[model samples]
Target chain A: MSLLEVRDLNTFFRTKHGIVKAVNGVSYTVEAGKTLGIVGESGSGKTVSAMSILQLLDTNGFIESGSIKFDGRELTTLTRREMYEIRGNDISVIFQEPMTSLNPVFTVERQVSEPFMVHQGLSKREAALRVLDMLRDVRIPNPEVVTKQYPHQLSGGMRQRVMIAMALACRPRILIADEPSTALDVTIQAQILKLMNDLQEEKGTSIMFITHDLGVVCQMADDVAVMYCGQVVEMAPARTIFGKPQFSHPYTEGLLFSIPRLDTPSDVRLEAIPGAVPHPLKLPDGCKFAPRCKYATERCKVEEPELVEVQPGQGVRCFYPDLKERRKDG
Target chain B: MGKYVLKRLVYIVIVFFVISFLMYALYNLIPTDPARAQLEPMRQQLKPEEYIRMYKQLRKEMGLDDHLVIRYARWMGIIKGLKGKFDGLLQGNFGYSQTFKKPVVQQISEPMKNTIFINIFATIAALGITLPLGVYCAVHKGKKFDTTVQTMSILGYSLPIFIISLIFMYFFVVRWGIFPLMGSKTPNATYEPGSWEAFVDKVYHIALPVIVMTFASLGGMTRYVRSSMIEALGTDYIRTARAKGLREKVVIYSHAWRNALLPIITSILAWFLGIFGGSVIIENTFSLNGMGKLYWTGLNTLDFELVLAIQMFYTVVSLIGSLLIDLSYGIVDPRVRVNK
Candidate 1:
């Protein structure tokens, strides 16, 4: 069995006007010791899907329907108390903004060792030693001094490193990094990404790397899932998804073209997506992307596409999955 | 830090001079003549010359005969422990209460004690009840507990303190006969130091007014705490704490509550200082002999000196409370520092 399996998961937020279908029928699986990257726009439900696995959704949000099984145990069915035990022990998460993620009141030592204190019943001394070791592992200079310092006292990169150390302290089987480098500078972003990759390799830990950056995904992801309008429109091996994307989904193509590369000349006019993602509440009939897709037909307007296998190790949701025709149509 | 404290102390001294000068000038501006009031009741007992002589003596003694500017300088000089009557080597005596015919400080000491005891108890009770309730409501949000607390808070806030005190007195003291309706204690009540019955009786007499004061301010505190908690919970750090798989208690109390309490702490300090001077209506309604009643009596009698003394006392207490609050900020939030 896969280490984590999300089957037809749906999450919605209850708002004053209507329910927001934030995560709609999303499904994926990750085996042990592998990385899965979820890529999408801000409201693509990538974060919600990850939060749902741990039942960490806020009071305003609810999982309408979902089955999340981790190592043969149904995660969705676990009580909050049971989930609490599994959270830092079996799975952990690192958020995008390191400055806000670490508690301002606590020292790095306390935050990093909290999981051990709560779950393993470790003594304070033992937890402290483990915190120092984890800090060393994340390449924090002067682990002792860094561990004693509060969150605000550290630089952005240092805080990010501290967060990574805290997340890895429990030796969790899975680490869910939600836009970990989004709040960091470009140079620091590369360093943090590289640090995460090294940590994953050394521990052989499965990682669910969530980001909007395709470049970061190419660097760290073993498999990639392209999400739009709360649904995974495409899933494939990272290289296949990047080199031979078979999907005719305009949104995916727009995302791929949007990334500014080093080779692109300064004067070259970058390809831009014409419009924003439609509000989930007012999602289009049949296909959510039909209004934006250049290849939309009468059939595309009336019927939604299923996530069907398009090639070996690849799946895409579209009435037409031919990129050659799409290129010509564009 | 030392420099900042010294600067604040100097500001406090300047404020003291301004307040004292205003009190003296404003009192003289009033239409009623302190000298005339003193002599009116004694007109039949003395001749016009005798009355004038008494007035002159009184004015000289009160330091009112001097030039207004000179008298203010003398007053400030006395406050700074310069030469004057009534132990000039120390700060000004605060003079005596014309209405009570007693030392102003002596007369105020008992009422000040009463006010501090009642308000301190009420403030603590209000905070203790409101904080957890607010956090619970914020965490549960739309649940039944939240709805119930919101409704009760609205109801509590709507009723004025005097009306609530009256209602409480009628129900608990009149109908049920469970507690005293007025005074800080029963007549002839004496504490035997180790006697449980005496301690209980003293507590019983003070309970109704304290409870009334507590409920009057509880709703506001609850609302403040709830709003602050909601804001803190919305911050990204709270989500991060939850993502760590920390227990719900740990996330709410350690992660969310610490940040959320900043506003609550400030409001609590304000409430503490505001009430420590006394809530006049509640004190009068309950017929408690506290500082609020003393202030009302002083005002009704036009006892300017007593009023000014009480006002000065309140100002000092509030200033100290604010200073304590500033220091506490550094303790609660690492982002701030006393020196900064």
Candidate 2:
């Protein structure tokens, strides 16, 4: 059984204008000890879907309908208290902005030790000891001194490491790292990814790594799920998706081609996907990506396409489903 | 941090000196003769020639006969008191109260105590109501409870203290007659102040003023705290705290409250410093012998010595209070400490 399975997840945000369908009919799963990279642009509902598994959406947002099963148990049916118990003990999440994530008033030790103290019922001193161990595990130098310091005293990378230490201290079964390195420089990003990869390897932890950067996903994901406008358009094994890319979700193609390459001539302009994300409250009736897709046909404008499995473990939600077929026709 | 505090302390000393000099100069501008204001009591007893002679001697004794700069120097105890010893305000001699016929320090001492007592009660009351209510209002922002509290806070904030005082006096004292009309204690009550009866009467008499002061002050404080808490609750750290699986109560009180407290803490310090200045409208409306009333009477009578002394007292207290706030800011926010 998959460690985490989300099916037909629909999340909505109630605002003054109307209800915003932030995550509509999104579905994916992560197997034990494997990483599932949920890649999307900003407001693609990637983070919202991940947050729905933990029921962590803000007060205005909630799961409209979905079955989030973890370890063969239906998470949707669990009481709030039961969900709370699972949150830090079995499932942990690291948010995007490292600079703002850690409480400024608290010492690193206090923040790092909270999960252990809360879920494990460890005393303050016992938690402090484990905090040092976790800090060391995350490879923070001078764990003792670092523990006594506040979040402001640490650099951006160090603070992210502290966040990782806090999240991983309990060896949670699943780690939801939401754009963990988006705010860091390239070198620091590499270090953080390597640390997460190493930790995942050691603990066999299933990770739902959410990011807009396809490169980071390539480095860490075992399976990749491509999302756009609140729906997953393509999902396949990371190797198949990155190498063959048999299924052509034009949005994914845009994302893949837009990445800057050093070998490309400096004068050659990178192709960027056209148009902005449709406002969540006022999305188009048909395919959300048809307006931006160059290969869109007349049928793509009037009818929304459902995700169909074209091969084993591969799904695509489009009429012109594969790039190879389009290449052959051309 | 220590250096920052020491720097603030030096600033406070400089502020105190500047404030004292300015207060002296400003009181001198009131178009009333300092010697005549003091001698108004003996105006009928002395002949015109005798009064002129006495006024010259009194001016000489009070150092008023000297140049403005020389008078200020003497007032700082660089010259002399009546006994020719160093006894100006700088030497802890607050001069005398012409209205009360006593030393300024002696006359203000009791009133000052009453002011402190009323303010302490009011401060506690204001904070006690504002902290929890503000948090609740922020947590339930845009809800009915929040709207109701905000309306009340607005009413309290906008209305002047005397208006609230009169309203309370009418309903609680005149209409119901359960509490006293005015004064800090019952007239001719035999109970000593240390006795429970006197304490109860004091509480009863001061209740209206304290409530009025608290109401007058609560609106701004609660609004400040509520907005601050709303901002703090929206901070990313608060989300982290929630993501940690902490209970809602723990998330708010533990994680959000301390961060929200920075602004409220400064305002509270100002409130504490205000104990010495007291609320002139509230004290005068209630006929209480507090610092506020003393200050009003001193100014109205043009008792330059008393007015200047009271002004110096408020300035010094407020300066020291601000210095403490700046120092405490370093302790509460690590970012400030590091930058320093």
All candidates' lDDT scores?
0.83, 0.87
Q: Please, what are the lDDT tens digits per residue for candidate 1 over residues A183-256?
A: 99999999999999898889999999999999999999999998998999988889886776655366677787
Q: Can you write out model 2's per-residue Cα lDDT over B1-340, one digit (the tens) per residue? A: 7777777778888887777777777788888776877688898999999999999988877767678766786787877655767878778888777777788989878888888788879988988988889999999999999999999999987876778888988998989987788888888888876899978888888988888788778888889899999999999888778777887788899899889988877887866765444477778888998888989999888787888887777776677678778888888887777666
How far residue B117's Cα lies from its native spot in candidate 2, in Å, is: 1.0
Query: Which regions in candidate 2 have their CA more than 4 angstroms from the true location?
Result: A262-268, A327-330, B37-61, B65-67, B78-83, B192-194, B271-278, B327-331, B336-340
Report how far off residue B115 is in candidate 1 (Å): 2.0
Candidate 2 chain A lDDT trough over 10 residues, lowest sum: A321-330
Model 1: per-residue Cα lDDT over B1-340, one tens digit each: 5555566677777777777678778765655556666777998899989988998887676666677767665644553322434342125466567899888878988778878777778888887899888998898887898888888989888887778888998999889998887876668756674499766775787798889888888787888899999999999878777767788898899989999988878887877865664477777877777788888998898887788777777777777787777667767876675225
Ten-residue stretch with the least lDDT total in model 1 chain B: B81-90
Q: How does chain A of candidate 1 score by TM-score against the true chain A?
A: 0.96
Estimate how well candidate 1 is docked, as a DockQ score. 0.67
Give all TM-scores, in the order shown: 0.91, 0.94
User: What docking tier does model 1 reach?
Assistant: medium
Q: What's the lDDT for residue B147 in model 2?
A: 100
